[model samples]
Target: MRTAVGIDLGGTELRAALVAEDGRLLARRSTRTDAAGGPEAVLAQMTGLVADLDLAGARPVAVGVGAPGPLDAEAGVVTGPPTLAGWHGFPLRERLAAALGLSVAIDNDGHAAALGEWRFGAAIGRRHFVYVTVSTGIGGGVVCDGRLLRGRGGLAGHVGHMIVTDDDVVCSCGNRGCWEAVASGTAFGRQARRAAAADPAGRIAALAGTAPADARHVGTAAREGDPAALALVAEEARRLGAGIVGLIHLYSPEVVVIGGGLSALFDLFAPVIADAVATRAMPAFRDVAVVPAALGPDAGLVGAAALVLAPN
Candidate 1:
């Protein structure tokens, strides 16, 4: 069976896999990203991980890597990515090809993720949809007419930068009051910490040893009927919904897929987000079905591999 290698490069770690054309995982490997050493080191680490997977006889055709951005997809370079500190203007595709000695493709993580779903996951039958994942940060990919929309310089569905909350939360993009700043995992941790510090009696506050009472912890507490924790989650769900509603109005996707670590509590937040959208979004936009991301962290890996195998 002919195969391809896919790599998902994030700020914290790098993952790669050998995959079948039909979306089966043949092999996989992972390594920590060298963000501290800058882009050169990060790229080198990615190269090493792919090598370790060793797709010897599978007829590896191409490589696809999904990275955090602002990226110049046309140029195969990452431009001033805020999530990856000190790695500015990284020539991703060039570096990987030189190191691995293989033809390579690169894309913003969101765009890569969208492609993964359309090709291998839930969006396979859907022609128009958006895959939005809220992880350490927020990101999304737009698919219209069965093509992933790579808006100028790979910054199209940067809905995380949308200013939904009035709070002055600073975004890595050097902006205040951005949606990511208020609605992502980073935001959840930040808010949970503040709430914990202020309310010593609250579940999040009383629960020591947990890191910053993040979205996960808060969600857990709310599930157990903790009022203070419920409040935190409710606020986050509201902001998340507001941002999503904006995407709905703009893209009119047939479905909106929400993934990422934060999505562990999709059951807790989904209804709240849907309610917010119902009340806030225009009636026409309100019909867009909101759903959980079909692919997990594996979505990026599967998607990246798919890119190499299919190469549109």
Candidate 2:
């Protein structure tokens, strides 16, 4: 079977994989992004990762990358994504093409993940849906009428930056009241840490066990029925659901697939998120399926490959 090279470049790690068209991961390699080293350093590391993957004698036809955005997908340029500092105006697609001697494609990581789920995971066969990744930051992609919505600048899927509240929380994107500033894993961890500080004897602190509290600890404590953690989770779900409600109003999607780090605990959050949607969404949109993303952590990688395998 023919294969493609997919790279998932994040603020913390750079991962590349050899993947079959059928969504099978043939081989993979990864390393820390060391983002502070600048674009050239990270580019070299990404190239090395692809070279390290076991290709099994099958030459990849193309390379696709899912990177943090504020990018120009059509132009294949990285245009000052908040997470990838120093990558402003970098011609990522052009550079990768030169480095790999293959055609290159690139898109926002969120958009890539949505494409992955659409083709091979949860949203398969669905013509309309939204995919949200609630990780260190919130990011999303919208599939409308069988097409991923890539606006003029390929910036249509930036649901995270949607201003969902009037609070003073400043997002990494330099905006106030962004959904990401309040509902992302980073927000959850910050809330957990604050709760832990106030109540050093609380379940969240205990779960942290001398380490810093994060979203995982909150999930664990909530699962254990700790009141503070439970409250935190409830607030998180409500804020997340509010964002989804906005999406429903805008897209009226058939489903909303939740993914990313916090999604590991979707079993616990789904119910609350669904309830929030049920109460807040219009009656016409209440029946939309709110489900966990099936692709897990590989969604972005597979979606990146899908960009090469299936352009749309």
Which candidate wins on TM-score? 2
Question: Of the candidates shown, which would achieve the greatest lDDT relative to the real structure?
Answer: 2
* Model 1 ranges off by over 4 Å: 54-56
RMSD of each: 1.7, 0.9
Where does candidate 2 stray beyond 4 Å? none
Mind giving the per-residue lDDT tens digits that candidate 1 earns over 138-207? 9888888777888787678887887876777788777999888888888888888888888877787767
State the RMSD for candidate 2: 0.9
> What value does the lDDT take at residue 223 in candidate 2?
86
Write model 2 residue lDDT over 169-208, tens digit each, in one string. 9998899999999999999889999999999999999989
Least lDDT summed over 10 consecutive residues: which range in candidate 1?
Answer: 208-217
